[model samples]
Target: MRKNKLSFQERAGSLQEECLCFCEEASREAMFQAPIELPEGFVIDPAEAVTNVTWNADSLSCVSERCFIETGPEPDEIAVQFAVRLQGTVTLLVSVSPVRNQYGQGNGAVSVIHSAEIDQVVYYSDEPDDCPDFSDIRIENLVVVPPFYGSPLSVTGTIVLVPEPDQRSYVFTANSGDSTVSVIDTEVNTLVSNISLSDIPTDLGVTLDKAYTYVLHGNANLVSIINNETLTVTQTTPLAGAPRKIQFETGGEFAYILAGGSSIYEINISSQTITNTFTVSPAADDFALDPNGQFFYTTNSGIWVVNKYDIKTGQLIDRLSNLETPNVIETPLIGDFAYLENGELRPNVVSVIDLTTFSKSSQINRLFDGLITIVFSDDGTRAFFLEPFPENLTVVDTAQHTMITTASLPGASDIAVTPDNQYIYAAQPDDNTVTVYRTSDYTAVSVIPVGTGPAAIAM
Candidate 1:
């Protein structure tokens, strides 16, 4: 049987709301904003493209179930063509801005613009999938159709882009009390390995290549690199001042470690040798880098503030205060904002730092007091707050700075979301297990047993 492919053709600068008018320069998955001119000669063509594009004042990560083709802009106006892969009968939800420039810059915000359901069936994929067939048909001139308010279970009908499972299928947790690291495979919800370490692990991070997992021991003042293939600690680097967090460059070319409460040690990946050292405010044990590794943020408890520094120029960019503790700082993959937990001895607050203007935009204080830990979804649309009021979880809508949902699960210490945005894995130390909750309904789907006293989690 021959498949009838849907071909998309759009005119530049003024794209129809129905076409795939997404602009991504760094990665295939783009967080797009209209009227924001993109660089010239932007291009990418692959055998299969699954793009999760975000647009608007408050942003979101959205993806369709089908595959798409790349479309570059013309000189003046933007034109794009998308060949979407289909199977049976599928409904796609898309938000398009009224295009305004040749660079596919949208003039207006991407308000919820949904297209009506199409009724056509065709041969979608050459092979079969475990999931149901949604669409595989043919259509033309897919101009602006009637607005579609889709399925209730779809969560505002936003097509959630699922990342490649082969690369990010395992959730890593650090059991500080047990001095061991447990690897949980999300595919089967089973414990793959309980790696016993020599020292208490404080934090964990996986390399970009998925080749190794780096474990930092703050008390022992050393780092252990575990080879994922062997599930064994292959190499160990001893450091001073109680090393805290481990970060990698985008290409896995270099690694940076925060140690001694006031220094960042940079290591060349190829040689695993100390390439350079940089100093920061004393008593600052935690630091975070922007997604591109161009900027860094560190907390200075001496003044109870967080400082943003330009990594290239080694100059301060902005400083944030009003925090009681100001010990921890984190940024999302999109690099638009920073999340800092506040009020260790006071009220629990999470300050949102606007990266563009380098200022404090808003503070989320709805969470309960005691201890607050937040983990952002892949696209920055949502954040999971770990509240210590007898162990509970709160889901906040990042765009509106509103609480979306809540779950009371006793013993939940820390939380980490899957790359696909489908599930939340919370480390329950009180129960000596990790609870898996479905993002769609906040239901506990699985409670897999893990090592004791799980304190931290990473994807």
Candidate 2:
């Protein structure tokens, strides 16, 4: 038999054609029968086989199931490539094949054989002149093996390409007993530092720009402004009376400080001076601002009343009465609805009020009596509530207006939800720890230890 030698161009073209065909078939299979969808703004690139490696049958025995193939200039292994353009959060679903010989163990086996095996998966951004280093690329999974011939093993994972607007980098918790503010790095879930205050810290408010954290000093008649970058108290503004709660404007230009009596002072951030004062009911305990910063909902602890006032003019817009101890007020990400934790004495419930009509739309009842704090999911479809006295956490579906489920926590004093809506953090003051539960399964994932009396939490 005579052997025919092929030219370099012919071999290259043949290999390219084979790669394209393989990719097309793989994509079709993935699209029709894939367990998960491919992330938006991303698509699988063609499978480019190594040209240096021979596909002859004699090489099949010597080939290892686990082999590394360098795709870029650096010597690194890559099973497949996905091209992405937009910058946002995305999850990748990848399918990999196991190493197997093309020819079966038979006497009349074919002369030419091919092998397919994928052991690991890695990813990196393909943009910018100075591409990300190898260290920046993350390996999502390894040691993946296909279950059957011509079928690829599938794996799913999530990643954040660009930082989310509400994805907090740090969380601030007020330890009243120790008179300190514990700063937690949300990325590592660790206590990075603690800022000691002169008096007991009652509440905390972080500016929109995250430049400073306003600490309300209990009975100190002052607000300690701690610079976030410096992690120290930069300035202290004296108030007329002791401040209980603090909320910031959208731009962080001014802060609304709820002091003793009926005073709500608007303090200028730059000058650290009280610019204006507005009066609500004599004993309004807590307040929540609408998303547009147009209206402020104030809850009166002593009476069953919630007062709505214009933020700019300080005029009474509407008053919702006939409630039981409406102490906490919260608006969802969308400003159309406001949830008020009311009926503290009997029939503990959350009043859902329409922001447009300023009327009670409905109420979520069957809650235990105790101090309550509420936080909404990022999408505003669900709400998580923390209640004391045989402490428990309840999740409510906003659209359905019903309680989805409840989990018992011995000392759940405070609760905060992540911006991504993946996890909820509940402060167990008596236990001196914070329990993190997964939003999808409602399973406790981690317990983070904090300072004594973790009274307040802000993310």
TM-score for every candidate vs. truth?
0.59, 0.60
Model 1 misplacement above 4 A:
1-168, 248-252, 269-271, 312-318, 321-325, 343-345, 365-368
Error of 2 at 296 (Å): 1.4
The C-alpha stretches of model 2 lying farther than 4 A from their native spots are 1-168, 250-252, 269-272, 301-303
How high is the lDDT of residue 223 in model 1? 82
lDDT of 1 by residue, 251-271 (tens): 577777888878787777666
The whole-model C-alpha lDDT of candidate 1 against the native structure comes to: 0.61
Pairs that collide in candidate 2 are none
